[model samples]
Target chain A: MEILETALMQRALIAAVLVGVIAPAVGIYLVQRRQALMGDGIGHVAMTGVGLGFLLSASPVWMATLVAIVGSIAMELIRAYGRTRGDIALAMLFYGGMAGGVLLINLSPTGSNANLSSYLFGSLSTVSEGDLDAIWVLAALVVLVTVGLRRQLFAVSQDEEFARVTGLPVRALNLLVAVTAAVTVTVAMRVVGLLLVSALMVVPVAAAQQITRSFAVTFVLSVVIGTAVTLAGTVTSYYQDVPPGATIVLLAIGVFLVLTVLATPLARRRARALRPERDEHPAAEADGPAVPAMRGPADEARV
Target chain B: MTTTQTESAGQDTNGAKDATTPTVLSLRGATATLGSRPVLRGIDVSLRRGEVVALLGANGSGKSTAVRSVIGQVPLTSGEVTLFGTPLRRFRDWARVGYVPQRTTAASGVPATVREVVSSGRLARTGLLRWPSKADRAAVQRAIDLVGLTDRAKDAVGALSGGQHQRVLIARALAAEPELLIMDEPMAGVDLASQEILAATLRDQVAAGTTVLLVLHELGPLEPLIDRAVVLRDGCVMHDGPPPKAVGQHALPGHDPELLTNQSCHPHAAGEPHRTGLLT
Candidate 1:
């Protein structure tokens, strides 16, 4: 067999499967919270952590994790300050995280070198066994917390106002989302690199959402999609002499585009098929046109 | 009274033969000041089980604050608010009270569907650290169906129309089958159809002996549906009986006569759903 024995290849495959399993699992929840872009922001923010480690000659992942968790908490705190207007909070944190990362890189003397690219774009060859261990630990932690706290997450994610009124402890849930985001960023740092990490966070989950309606199903499917992309990219990179990070991203994008396009036609057909159901009840009676407070882009905004 | 004033004693018009026995919620000398600005003050209101109470107030008249305080969203500056005979401060299990805040917009932006959002109604009763039981799931489905939102239950709430969106919120509240359903403004910004559906659904809840306390800016539309009305102005109860008596001089002692006659408070601006965030 040509694949006799090699540590890099073996490690890459193991890392790929592990990263694939965890990234999208957590990404699904993050995306639903509209914190998908947050991954990119967080990855960029993590540069300071990476730079701090690089400067002090410490573990880059440790430095990145600390800085990232602190930054993520700050981001959440700022968003909560919006007083029922939290959308502004999300954008402020997202862009602010990205900006911070850039500044950190600028101060690093090795800024001109490929250090940023290696971390930002991700280096598959650098996925050491130690990094895999962290990914495993993070993945396990994510599953436990997500399952254990699913109710709290659902309550807050669906309706913070009602949740707050009901006394569901929303502040704690908000903090959880942030802390999880920090964990995802830390684990993602080694496998996917910081630059493209956000895409990894959003694309698979978003792609999964188009096909599924339920949150639980969407979450599971996202992990499946993430695994596929990781495997496809890893294999293609090895055989095609392609850059691993770019290859993985491209593979993920390809899958997302195909699924999105395919889902549109299928959904349309189902809607057209619902004409008989519509005719059964007069539009004004069962489907009576009360004030249209339910659907529409305009209504969502004021809501 | 600047305008015509009138008075009436406790009148029973509903068919709840023995409804005057036990009260489900009570508020006494309650005042809520959001940063020195009193949202509600000197309020004295109580409801017996099966009472369909409507709260009416002018814009910024503390109607919302009153509903919020009973649910413990805002701390009472003074006085006491109780649910199910237990004071709010000591009332640990709020699960029995299914509250729909006046502002559904508070949760409008989350990326959840009509069904998922509705399922949240059972959060308090579902226990914090456990998965929902089969009954929980059924309750969620029943609530969605009750609100006539089964078709769009799978659609992202962000993708739904306005009226359907309100149904989702209603569904969320109904899922818990709360003994006391405290709604901020269930009919606000909703289409006439959604309102009608909600009214119908609420009627069923009434039949089942569920008490509802909701805030409203206007009573013109929901007039026929409500059993009683309580009007508040400047943090104090102006009128506490029924909608008919809570206007003009009968609107309570402290209410500003100018507000009811001239200023349109039923559908105020704050209740209007403004385009809120950067989600798009």
Candidate 2:
């Protein structure tokens, strides 16, 4: 509790909490769409924005957000329209973004690889008041879009073709997702670092799904897990002299492992509970057509 | 507002001449290409109100492409598509239409309950921005009941078998209570019991006067409900009349090898462009 007296710890804690709530909130949709790695790609692109901020003497947070949004939109366009070689196009964009940041930061008057490292690996203690303000505003927008339109986003992420037939603005919604993800990348850049931002986005959701049976529960539980791990990691970093970003991501993975271990027994119990219902239907055997009812005892023994 | 367009288009397709039954979906001279190869070459398909139309074809025959084009999933290179007398580009009342894509499983990367998946179908009626109302929830429940998935509504969709998974998709489509239902390969790879459940569900929907357009490999149990069949071969319509009769259970799809090659019921030549200038 004595750490609460320090303004630096207070700022780090606030940023950590914001990261906890919104990262998984946005990441759930990404996971649902099977684009879990998309957050990682956006993180790569945001580095160029951070470098541009240093080169232009502007706030890196805001600059990173703007550049990430543009980069993500380009990624979305490639996803929507690229015929073949889409992976190659995406690979180029990702590495180009990373390379662009390294080159630009070196050319800047006040920036070097040292300045860029802060954003790449996070610097919670170095979070300025201006950076805090921008993080708040950007975090608010992410929450609004993620929570306000959960149903529509859920529908689109669940099935793009079905959403289109429902007369949803599929292309527009996709662009919005890209933009939201970009914003999320920047919001997390300060606390989780660019490299590990995606871990916060994806790991918590994956961990929650192991024990959860439905999307709504998974959504709520993942946010809970994200918030818990981030707060714990931030506080641990305060005392243990470790990087908050790495600590937080490691904690999320730990939760995933624990859940995975627990899920096996839970699933078996569930199967036992549903066994009678399954026995009555016997639809599980329907997929196999090769085995005839008149199969010999030899075949049964061999199997 | 679109009555004049309907009358003109209706007159052009002789089967839709009856003034009482309005054309729900009309596609004329619809040409579409997938990659560099043409998937649909000038096909005409029209469905009247309350009609159960089946789009039948072998692999790569463009039946799936035709239905996908109708739902605006597959863009047409040159064609006219009208839904409920309104041209596709101008038609915005999507609440009247429901679509079930050809999918082997309804499970996504994340877990979702049967009710959560089905509730999404109500989005057409609720619009994209608004939350579901009480009426919307009731409608969703009714849809699940209609598909006989009420017991499994709260269960995760990933736990369901193939047939039950299809049932969830059908229930999702029915949630909107749409006037028109478009399904692609609704019965592909489904077990016998699930197929029977799906047929019964479709039977109820048809009796309730919901217009249906489905793509199927063959006329199976749904043969009794099908009012017409538009069979495609190599991106062209080969037959557009009563369902080609199956000689017996042996002639059912996947059982009879001769069914795919047989052309006795096809009156039109394959690959010939449809000359009926009726704009969709």
Candidate 3:
């Protein structure tokens, strides 16, 4: 209660709640697309933006946002157009961003290695008035855009090829999602740091997915789980004298583990209930071509 | 089945229908490449309004690519594609078209009820930043009923069988109420019962005058509904005429012995015994 009275703690709490709401909103689509790791890639790339900001004597949060957006878009392009496999392209951006950040910090006279560690592992003490303002503005942008394009985003994430055929402007929507994800990574970095931002984005959504049947319900539930874990983790960190970022992530993981444990039986029951009537219709099942076994001459020749 | 054939044949010769109908889709010398290999090499195919055409071919013969090119999924390296007389690049009336992709096991990983998935099909028609209207809801319900999945509409699609899942996809496409419906291998992994349901559903669509372009491995239950068949061989249109009546025979004119010999070396040729009963 004493810690809650302080302005710094209150600011941190507000930021945490904001991130908790925004990160997983964006994360649901990322998880749906099986691109959960994309958040991590963008977060790593954001470090370079932070380094660049320090070098340019600018606000690191905004710089990180700019760099993250560019990096994310570039990642989308690379995934689409690169000669290499999609994951390989993402790997390139992930490592390159981290390496570039390290090199830039070392080279910049203003960037002290000592201070850089604070950004690496978040320090709640550093959430100044300006940082809070930036977080709110950026968080609002991300949330609004996500809400505004929810249907299109959902359609694209569900089936990109189908979305394109429907004339949903698939490429533009994809870019919008990439940019939103990048913004989410940058905003979340203030509390969780780049190292653990993706955990906040993915874990809650994953937990929500296990229990919820509909995307809308899953989305709303993820925010609830994320906010609860973040607030509880913040309070625990204050009492235990530990890093809030790591505590928040660990708490999320703890909640996830608990949910998984509880969900096992429920999942089993649901699977049993939903299992197709294979026994009753063995002939029909056997009549349909087994997709894997339907390999044509081209596949056979290759083997 | 005989009734379906007679109806399709009658519709085909109805000179009054030809005079009033317009071309819904046209692919003129469309050429495309996937990674350096030419997948669609100078193909020409067209569909008239309310016509049900099947794009058929052996695997690697460019049937999928041709349909993909029409839908703008495959970038054409040369030639032109037009949707309702509008150039592909300039066409923006997407609500007028519905597409069902080939079924894959990769379920979006996000659990959605059948109703919700079907409703997404109406997104284009619903437009952006607005809640669905009464009409939209009614259309979605109608589509669900069309596919005979009204009872399961609230169930998560992940819980459905492969056949039911395919029906949900078809229902989704139907929700749009588009004039043109294009599907890629809609029955590839679907059970016979599901295929019959799909055939009946498509029969209704044909009766309602919807244009359809389907890519299929074999005609199967859909043979009776098809008014025309376009066969592709090595990225070229080998035949464009009546649907082949023989189930297991690749009986197109100018059959290449070399291609047949090459295809025979591969384990699953086009004329396998298992493919017969599904169609005939």
Q: In what order do the candidates fall by lDDT, top score first?
A: 2, 3, 1
Error of 2 at A200 (Å): 0.3
Off by over 4 Å in 3: A270-303, B1-20, B249-280
lDDT values, one for every candidate: 0.72, 0.86, 0.83
Residue A256, model 1: Cα distance from true site in angstroms: 3.0
Measured on C-alpha atoms, candidate 2 has an lDDT of: 0.86
Q: Write the per-residue lDDT of candidate 2 for residues B189-239, one digit (tens) a residue.
A: 888999999999999998899999999887888888887767677776655
User: Between the candidate structures 1 and 3, which one is better when assessed by DockQ?
Assistant: 3
Q: Write the per-residue lDDT of candidate 1 for residues B156-255, one digit (tens) a residue.
A: 7765656777777777878887888888778778888888888889888988989889787766455666777777765556655546644343334334
TM-score, cand. 3:
0.87
Worst 10 residues of 2 chain B by lDDT: B1-10
- Give the lDDT of residue A51 in candidate 3: 86
What's the TM-score of each model vs. the native?
0.79, 0.89, 0.87
Tens-digit lDDT string for candidate 1 (A149-241): 776776776556678766687887888777777788777666677877777777888787776657767777878888888887877777888
Model number with the top TM-score: 2
Candidate 2 interface RMSD value = 0.7
Answer with 2 or 3, whichever has the higher DockQ.
Answer: 2
